[model samples]
Target: MTKAYDLARDAYAAWGVDTEAALAALSAIAISVHCWQGDDVGGFERKSGTSGGGIQATGNHPGRARTPDELRADLDFAFSQIPGRHRLNLHAFYLDSADNPDRDQIEYRHFTPWVDWARDRGLGLDFNPTFFAHAKADDNLTLSHPDPGIRDFWIEHGRRSRDIAARIGAALDSPCVNNIWVPDGYKDTPVDRMAARQRLWASLDAMLAPAHDPAHLLDAVESKLFGIGVEACTVGSHEFYMGYAARRDIALCLDMGHFHPTESVADKLSAVALSISNLLLHVSRPMRWDSDHVVLLNDDLLAMAQELVFAGLLGRTRIGLDFFDATISRTAAWVTGVRNMQKALLRALLLPQAHLKTAEEQLDFTARLLWTEEVKDLPHGAVWAEFCARHEVPAGTALISSLNAYQQKVAARG
Candidate 1:
């Protein structure tokens, strides 16, 4: 019998990822940039110094602060890097430096250059906004209170964002500063959370009701753990006014990395599929402690995510890499993660629709349920060994060489 991996290899190899077509698929591309190269290596398409709430490539890794010119050069580099025919879009997330010349300057001078750079790359500016108000050089800041300083900081921050929007709209261009994440939702008490929620969506309300074009929408990202409100933040969105947001056609950003043990992947994707106006795709892996490892796909999580995509639950979704590369330099991390993700995606496209259907259909509730509950705790080698033993995949030294050769062939393209 032909195995799934063989099918995946064949399907992906022949898969028509026409460059021009792929470029057209991007609503935005959340890019990962490094400080060390500055404007070298042709820069990046979405040349931001950061990507996620904590994925500050420059700070997390060792990179320098780029001057605007260098940043522009980086943009040019990225623009030229993608084949003009390929469909690569941009979503720029500028790491709003607290040390910059006030909120106004950061928005106008610091961030705008990159926004313009995005245009040069045939991209758009759909930022995730800044992550909370407070400044912390500590990983220990997770789930901490919204520092008073941070809250006030964000207020002024939002104002500056509004200024930039006016500038972009005045130019008749689309300017979106997406506010989809709240890193400060961890609290212990059965707390009154309305005020906090209001602060989160105030700008979104402005966009939906009395603001500019009703087409201008904010994407809300829902999570399952490890931030304000321990269990306070559920897997799916539980905002203060979801109905109002929905009425406005406010969309949701579904991060595959955020689903927990209890949430049914099928159920969640179906729900997200309905809200297309404001969709953001965040992909990552869940580790032993529920920590976001930002690892490769095939993590079982993406298997579930793929099931949704295959079912047409995520039609025309804009995907973003809200990932982290903690072990290596941020630049290298981008190359590794993005390359691996493409491989996983190709595998997804190659998955046997019939097999998946049969598995789901044939599954006894008790047996199929094991997939949702059982997360491997041992080293990956052992886990893979066990899985290979059960699934009957090609194993041993030759298998490693085969996979490596596959990766090398894919990587050597550029």
Candidate 2:
């Protein structure tokens, strides 16, 4: 069973206007305003090319797909749904357009514009560049995608994107980033140059390590199962750390919804903890191999949360509510879901740290019982355990469940 999503951590009523509420919600929370609707990191209005709302044929499509103003508007709504006052780690993946790189990637034309917007609102920044060389390099050949216009992300832009972060002053400081799931892995025996693909990120880390600043931020590697031959930017199910550690402050970006139904969340966390930075968690009734970032805690609440927590990922972990909205009213649904998560986090924070330690390290009990004991779970578990437990709930299940129940009451009203 998967983990039950905790939206209550996101939606509890603000205790007061003080910065404490904001600080409590800040590090543990952030969102990809656009991923709610697939990977249109630009949040562009999607219409057929024939339709006027579609991306227009232009030299630069800053306003063609979506405007910077529209993006800011979405975040404003996001901040409201999040519990208490907080900051943001914005995604600008749409900026990497065929026609324009800077405007489409992490910018809306000029760096100062985005900087001004965040500074005005007091939110921090995180974004990717269109030209970063992250794609699997096909220097000698051109590849065809089952889906048209989808560039070979691993070959073309993987390194370019990484390079931009090194060069850009702003990107270096943003709290977090999302690495595109480069679908370049070869299902066949003779693959494209694997060494080159590996080198792309390695070089990036080697170059940036000297310049990396903890204050500048970390990178989150988003993994995937299908799309491009099951071979994506994440490297593979195991050697995840090899690719991630290449970039300074970089970590694995786990999307709860990204794995196949068979893949256990607990197992995934255990296998990939060495590289984890933040979680791009998704929740929803899943289809076969499809990604639906919805709110589906009730489907299997206990198992989901338990696995996530067992893997040492829960409280104090940065969360991005990846939800989609078909209409403006859906914004309420998305926001409500986020609120539920925040409320659940509160319960997790209250969990006793010492008791969890014994069960997890000494007793070697199940992840479920590790936190249920009288004492709290300590922050330091065995290195191997830490590798697996990415969402360690600081607070206990009771607090999280109670707060979540309260939010359910609120959801019932709407």
Candidate 3:
């Protein structure tokens, strides 16, 4: 350990916080890193089309992975820079196979390469069904489409996705979280929102009817407020999925970018934890809307980590990142986002919660406030540096040269 870390540890110990315990806790929490950012949400499926269903990667940034191998290479480098053993969050369309197959026809064998790769690296995998970027979803509808045929196609895709997730989890000895998020809504005001929701309800029920071992697969549903085309109405609104997940006793995914700009996802954690057995967080930085910007070490992110630690919700919560920024180096984006998340979590773990909670319980609001603000200026950076050093990962400016070199290497993909 460095002298700085020792000093920082002693300082934290003065606050009745065990820095060693906090570091151990931080190491145990794995952040599920999304793979879409490596290639701007472009999957490797043959005959893939543009992402039209409110999903768009807005940049001509070079080095975008064109194949599954290239994407995995990028992911491999990205994971090296991160400090912990994390999981990979994958979309269904990111399949790897020699033969072409539609979404509904996909099988586990198609994704065996990914499973094998993850297994070799001792990593877990989570999954999502691609509900957009196809002829079926061209109208910004899928599960809730008015046409029965389209609905059936997406329902089958959902079923296939769950099976794939189960197989992946079983292979890796981890429970894969299968999350479903559809871009089903209306650009203009719809005549009947109820009809669309009814169809969605039926479609989801049919898709999730088959049961899988909870040890292998955990199902989650994500909600969105609005999207590029779906401005007026989003069929699967927060309220809709909140109730659905509660009734079905499944996980509810809360994306930071999916809610209104002013809303606090941190506050919703404790409230939603009461209704659902599991909570999946899609951690993203939303500017004014669902911009999906790279996460930073900002107040919003810190508040979320604080809530997860203080509320004692970490055990039941699955932390997953959801951001796609094609504007910068893709691997660098992953490293920065994932590292920032870890930093936030470490800071939360280092908090003197016992003192704060005791003060709160005793109605000493002044002491609570003082301590809350006081902990903000603690030596979190020193401890975080030690963590990166222990993991043999570069910290701060050292990563810039590595990212620059990788960018230069991949720039030849033209």
Candidate 4:
């Protein structure tokens, strides 16, 4: 394997690509893996009936983590199989509460265990305000709800979430990316769209008014094109959030699965980077709609990585995974999605960017096309294998056996 990597390294070197530098850079990147994937987005909050959040995890896959300990154990197993250190993304509803508390009343004490867990493992943490699947959101309106009392409830929840995120970051000494994504929209065209948006704008302003140290917390707002119930009009559309983020100078989250099926979220990276100082990408796969399937090393994923690399915006971007698949082993899903994302980044780093850029600058379009096609056939797999080996992780299909053994001995245990 070392010989193969040596040869591959020489080949990349000929293209003016430093394989060692690429590996070092890739190692420094930490993708935020969402915790919802392990438990099908089910939180410990006491909510009767099914989730009303316009989102649903469509499988009864056994072995879903029922407690905070189980979830942490599963996350530990998943992280072991994937190379590189990564952060964990959590929702406010996932609080370790014995007496299910209301969203607005949640305090940081409920999440101290998570902080301790992450601190002990040397992992960073990110957070989200759970604006869905709760009683306040039962009417499909949260921050935009006409009733001031109801709107205030959600606003307070958002505020508490940000404070908690700051605490997590302060405890770990790493800035936590606290993202806000509300499931407020209409199933059909509304008579007062403008009024609803106005209310939402005001609500956000109030929620984000309290200043937290930027060193400990970074704020972001996520938008979606549509969802299961909010088909006709989503209050937080892409245009809305983009404008708000630019005007407010906050990070904008570009969720891969939250856009139109025909639109490439990768293409929007550079465009959004122009206005927003920091960007957060919620990497996911969209099947027809916002299905939130496990990510694959497909063209879209590759394009996103290449765009980030080419634009030299990787350091400024927060890359995170946002998929949940319950049909397969949850731990396996986490490992597969995170590894595929790492693979995409590695492939992007292996590209002969200097040559390609020179060809384009010289107006040698043919040469640019030729080099692009040629690099695709290069021995990237060998380099990736070497990366995994260096990181002391299983390369290629070898991870499957480890995942299976873990499922039987740990995840599947009642």
Q: lDDT (CA) for every model shown?
A: 0.41, 0.41, 0.93, 0.91
| Positional deviation of residue 223's Cα in model 4 after best superposition, in angstroms | 0.6
What are the TM-scores, per candidate, against the unseen true structure? 0.57, 0.56, 0.99, 0.98
What TM-score does candidate 3 get on C-alpha atoms? 0.99
Candidate 2 worst ten-residue window by lDDT: 48-57
- The residue ranges of model 2 lying beyond 4 angstroms of the native Cα positions read 1-66, 87-89, 93-111, 129-174, 178-180, 185-212, 228-249, 274-286, 298-317, 323-330, 350-414
Worst 10 residues of 3 by lDDT: 43-52
Report per-prediction Cα RMSD to one decimal.
10.4, 11.5, 0.9, 1.2
The full ranking of all candidates by TM-score, starting with the best, is 3, 4, 1, 2
lDDT, candidate 2, 74-181, per-residue tens: 456545435443444434443323344422233234344555666776665554433222232222111223221333332334344444443343543454453444
- Candidate 3 per-residue lDDT, tens place, 77-129, comes to 99999988999999998999997999999999999999999999999999999
Q: Give lDDT: candidate 2, residue 198.
A: 52
| Tens digit per residue, CA lDDT, model 4, 276-299 | 999999999999988899999999
- Model 4 scores a C-alpha lDDT of 0.91
**TM-score: model 4 vs. ground truth:** 0.98
User: lDDT by residue for model 1 over 1-414, one digit each (tens)?
Assistant: 235433433333343322222223221233322222332222222323222332332223333214445344433432332212112222223432334343323454445555555556555455443433334313212222246454444445544555554454344264353544545443354365555455445534543333444233234444445543344442223433345346656556555555564554435555655544555555555554244444475656456445544665445444545554434333334333443444344334433444445557886556445533432211223322333344343346745454445334333221
